[model samples]
Target: MPDIVEQHGVPVLVCEADGVSIGTVQDALDHLIGAAFTGAEVVAVPSPRLDDRFFDLSTGLAGDILQKFANYRLRLVVIGDIGRHLAASSALPDLVREANRGQDIWFLPDLDALADRLGPDGAGRKTG
Candidate 1:
């Protein structure tokens, strides 16, 4: 189970690095429902837990999963270094750049970054 923690006043579900791998759209829905039931406004998933295919934009897995999360108004943060994968693809960097600027899905370097994005001084932005 994901550990629910309050970050900057936001209910966040922090997924362990070794938790269930998110390899399919169903997996994304499962996580979304879990977060919803727990009253979590955000979910932080370790990058290692994401399937390698997730970084490959050609697979459509990333778009599908992210779209589901966005549709549900759930914020998803992918935490970890995806430097190698970013180095492997040209289009992916563009995707990451765009996602980082959004309110829903974010690709961050660490938990600290997630906290910062949510809010730095323990006052989180209202998630609606």
Candidate 2:
């Protein structure tokens, strides 16, 4: 099970590094449910949990999965290094840059970044 903790008063479900990898849309939904059950407003998934296909813009898997999170009204933060995947795709860098600029989803480098995004009062940048 993932750990549930509060960051600046916001509930966050931090996915374990050794947990099941998310290679499909179903996998993303499963995690969303996990967040809901934990009463988490945000789900922080480790980079290893994401399959390589998620980083491949051509696969469309990332969009499908992230949509589930947004539709469920939960925030998602993919934590870790995606430098290699970014190097392989032309459009992914743009996507990451755009996502980080938004609230519902973010591609952050670490947990500290997550805290910063959550902000001092947990309202984040744009609010939910």
lDDT of each: 0.83, 0.85
Reference-based TM-score of each model: 0.90, 0.92
lDDT of 1: 0.83
> Which residue runs does candidate 2 get wrong by more than 4 Å?
121-128
Candidate closest to the true structure, highest lDDT = 2
Q: Tell me each candidate's RMSD, in Å, in order.
A: 2.2, 1.8
Tens digit per residue, CA lDDT, model 2, 1-128 = 78789888888899888888899998788765455676888899888899999999899999998888878888888999999999998999999989887778888999998998888654365543
State the lDDT at 54 in candidate 2: 95
Best by TM-score: 2
